[model samples]
Target: MKNILKYMSLAFVGGIIFASCEKSRPVVYTGENFVAFEDTLLSIPESSAKEDANGETQAIPSIATIRINRGSGDISKDLVVSYSVKAKYVTTDTLGNEVILGDVPEGNFYLSSPGAVTIKAGEGFAFITVTVVDNDQTDGNKKLTFTIESTSDASFTIGYPGPDKKAKSMVLYIEDDDCPLDINDFVGTLKVEDVAIVSTPLEHSYLVTSTQVSPNSISILGLFDPVTRYPSPTPCPAPVVLVFNTATKDVIFSPTTQTAYYRSGGCPATTNPRVVYPDPAVPNKFNTCQKLFTLNYYVRNPSASGPFDFVYSTVSKP
Candidate 1:
């Protein structure tokens, strides 16, 4: 009787250890990329792009999305299942800032809902995972909304099948949208006075060389001339030095930043003219346009982040 009792205790301890190891088993969800492996953060072109004068509204990609994998590890018959998805971006910046990279959306993707994993009654661990979207819609009221959601849930192991290998299949699933934005009805007479720096291949895009600031939407200054001296060399009516916030889209006539104020100056007269600052989007690099400003421009963005910068988009008086 003593021997039997000792043997039973040993079996119990062994069973407990096995159970603990079993609980810590990793669920391998085999997944693939949309096009390339690096496509984890795949970028789409502009949902809507318009050609100038003769230009028409054309399509450009601009959505980013992904899929999840659920493997049928050594299982036979399909097992009942549910799954949850989680995803993240590679960069520290929030998902949308016009200049910052964008996010993935489900509206234009073909991610399926989760279902069951198949396995025999004696079979163990068969998982099926599908699609999840982490969408950061670029720019929203100057604040970005980075969201990720799952179309499924994780599953529980039912039983175990005889040891055998299995494989699962996956495919790309993203489609372009017809009208993601209000680019259809809201047409403003934008005097695309100037197209400033959008890309600088050889420099950091966050520094401004020289910034001029004053009051009254000073962010619209587009002068290609030099600031004059006062006293003996004073220019007529004293030119109002214009200033702008290349970041934050802030503008002020008196040196405030990112506020949209009606430009109040022009070249020569320098009054009531739009102001364009040195390109802060790219530092240590010079843009072809020495001057940048828009006239008769109308922007339909409910928020102020949207600026009109089409080249020759509007007829210029000068």
Candidate 2:
């Protein structure tokens, strides 16, 4: 009887092992493999195209990329992905806010050629060029939607449901050039934390003002004495001129401008003889909305060199 019981126990263990192996078997997709956009979303910046010497806008097209992976089988041939543009993907609510629930009417604000993209054999990626045309409309609510429908091969599927809906589909917003500039967004008091003047260290705070010099330029002013929080005694120096690239949020300091002023005083009463933007200063950071900005620079002169950091906080403008 004991021998019989042992045999039964062994049979039960073997059955359990067999069940687990069957359940854990890898799922093999016999259909054609698939491809998706490299990124879930693409944001085309405002003023994406540059103007030529004649002031005519250059033709600039936004590009979206697609990629695929080799499953158990190698891709022996090219895989072509066909896509379409539709207006039924999103809509705006009564409040003018974007609601991604329903679709809108079809339009020609965006155009794409060859509606299909091909992922070459042995290669995993391809790009689609999308051109955006200005409609001369001031409305800030323009958008374009693209969807991947089917592929040349049968085994692949379009986009996955939920979480990944953006991967197989995308919405592009066309920024309005006539939108009002948010001037107060970058005007505030910044703490000039550190000044490396040769050997003497000077720390102070100053107020900065922003003036829109052009569609893509801003003049920075109101830089005052850090200690007194007043205008620098030297009135002969000029304010720094910055070219703000709205698309990239990059502030480029014009080389022709002088950021630091020379002070005339006593021992070198020469208390603070020189203040200049260090060439090694780190790049500044700005937000997409231009509401806030961070300024970073190294201060150096014949006397000392060190980092100066400032963070722009929101303040009410008079």
For model 2, the stretches where C-alpha displacement exceeds 4 angstroms are: 1-32, 49-72, 88-104, 108-114, 160-166, 180-318
Candidate 2, TM-score vs. the true structure?
A: 0.37
lDDT over C-alpha atoms for residue 86 of model 2: 51
Model 1 RMSD to the real structure? 19.9
lDDT of 1 by residue, 117-200 (tens): 233333332222222222223222111121122212233221121132111122222222222222111122211222322232
> Which number leads on TM-score?
2
Q: What's the lDDT of the predicted structure labeled candidate 2?
A: 0.46
Candidate 1 residue-wise lDDT at 220: 25
Which RMSD values do the candidates have, in order?
19.9, 18.0
Across 1-318, the per-residue lDDT of candidate 2 in tens digits comes to 000000000000010011234576844434445556555555554345678999998745333233323231445566777766553333357587656554343333222322666666655455555444433233344455566777888766565434454467776554445333354454443333334232344554445555667665556654544333346433333356656555445566665324544444432243443343524345654553324444544433445544333322222232
Worst 10 residues of 2 by lDDT: 1-10
In angstroms, how far off is 191's CA in candidate 1? 15
Estimate every model's Cα lDDT from 0 to 1.
0.25, 0.46
